[model samples]
Target: MAARSSHLSLALLLVMAVGCAAQDYDFFYLVLQWPGSYCDTRQSCCYPKSGKPAADFGIHGLWPNRDDGSYPQNCNPDAAFDPSKVSDLLSELRANWPTLACPTNDGLRFWGHEWEKHGTCAANAFNEHGYFQTALRLRDQLNVLDALTSGGVSPDGGYYTLGQIKDAIKRGTGFEPYVECNRDESGNTQLYQLYFCVDTAGDRFIDCPVLPRGRACSNRIEFPAF
Candidate 1:
């Protein structure tokens, strides 16, 4: 009896060790949107059914625009993400934050799905937090709109009080624009860039590959919501 108990304890310890190590090497990238117009439910896992706040953009998976020079097809949400086997890394990566919160009981179905398919949400929580760093850059565009009613703010400092923030995106001040990642001509991972410039007249325009928001701002600020 004593020997059996000792063996059981050893097995339990080994299992615990394995679980911890699994989480350590697990590097995940949240995809804000999948290719085309569909959200890959198999890869979205950050938020549950509680309904994400207006400001939260779960995770946008990797965008492959530069890879084939053409947008990729939508992902099949039922695809699996392997937690074990390092060799399956890429496959799992294709579904990092897998979810089952959609109204459809079949597969990839959830609230964030719609926003992500359109490249509206953040690629991950980290990306969302980064946007807040330079709140001022977006404040001019994000402020006036009633996030719940108005889609968002207008570019000319005009307020919209009855639409979705996605719609309000048209009102952006163009300081910190969205970014697009793809491979370069040299076949290397490259980040396309876009910057904000305050002209002599104090005007800004949306430019090239936008950088991750709040990353360039030297000052840090907190965004409560919207």
Candidate 2:
């Protein structure tokens, strides 16, 4: 009887550990990247089987981060991303968050990686469906391409100051954004990714408690066409 009691206690501890692991973050970062800069570089990218993605930015992830700029990743091994859990959202995901990795696929691998590394860390606030749907909804809410275009910062391979880009996004979303840059083949710095801070609920954009430690962009950078 005593041995059975010991086993029960051990099981309870494991459950507590998993719970703690999942709830250990403060906020979410919805990161979106320009497919143009992704594919136009020396390191080429392949389009997903779902076909070419829109000219706009595609989701990189919705990462769980803390105010200190730290983050949690792969918190639950047992909570591997099951594609079936987000089956209903597959179509929408394919259009909006499609993968551009070499040797193209249906993009299950990209979503799976995000789930295990980031989504699992936020299990307290979201299950699989909730997590994925939240990303899609956030992307829908903040149309970066449209925002930039409306502000005359169109991605016609045009040059714009870093401040101009951030202001455009702020005007569109009612909150500022952090712009990340990457070099293309010619070594010219160009816009790469955009980061937005989401509430703990993953519902609305808020002023970032702390921006990510991303690479520096010049005062002027290109918004290259995809």
Candidate 3:
């Protein structure tokens, strides 16, 4: 009876360790938001405290996703956000990841949520500062606006075929992206978000799996003007 109890305790310890290890994510989903579509759909958009962001796709969040199309979030309960850790990268974050929510457009709150949820899951691979810096660097490399415009898919309230949008992004990043859209008041579907899959190291882009949910886009999508 004593030997069985000791073995049971060891087994329980191993199971707990495995559960904790599973919290580390396998890859990243770099999500970007189009301000034009966001504001148009929401019908109310405000900029960050700093000022209005440029008419471009902003970084929404860099989430950690698993192979099964699921993602780990809020992995570390004790992971309190420390703004000072990312102070050096604030300027770039403000420019690229501005909060577009209305009534109270606070970038800090957005960042805090992102860090606590997604960033904590990736803490094993990257510290707080590293997680944010990696996202900024990835965003700089993937210029969605330039890619679409250069491919004759300008954002002048014009509708572009889904093929054109995907082709342009693939041509720009050398990897296909996941396109999502939202509808405006006029009932027209507009480009909303773009997501690119990245490896666990956060160094290179990878082809994303078929998303678990259907994409929020029509065959034709409007890249609404901001």
Question: Runs in model 2 with CA error above 4 Å?
Answer: 1-23
Ordered by TM-score, highest first, the candidates read 2, 3, 1
TM-score of 2: 0.90
Model 2 Cα shift for residue 151 (angstroms): 0.5
Which residue runs does candidate 3 get wrong by more than 4 Å?
A: 1-23, 210-215
- Residues 118-183 of candidate 2 have per-residue lDDT tens digits of 998888888999999999999999988888888779888889999899888888778788899998
Winner on TM-score (1 vs 2) = 2
Instruction: Output the lDDT of residue 191, model 1.
Output: 24
Better of 1 and 2 by lDDT: 2
Q: Which pairs of residues collide in model 3? A: none
Candidate 1 vs candidate 3: which has greater lDDT?
Answer: 3
lDDT by residue (tens digit), candidate 1, 12-128: 999997665332311211123212112222232243343332332223332322112233222333322222322323232223323334453322343134323312222222232
lDDT (C-alpha, whole model) for all candidates? 0.30, 0.90, 0.86
Error of 2 at 153 (Å): 0.5
Instruction: Report how far residue 143 has shifted in candidate 1, in Å.
Output: 15
What is the TM-score of each predicted model, taking all chains together?
0.23, 0.90, 0.89
Angstrom error at residue 40, model 2: 1.6
- Candidate ranking under lDDT, highest first, comes to 2, 3, 1
Candidate 3: 10-residue stretch with minimal lDDT: 207-216
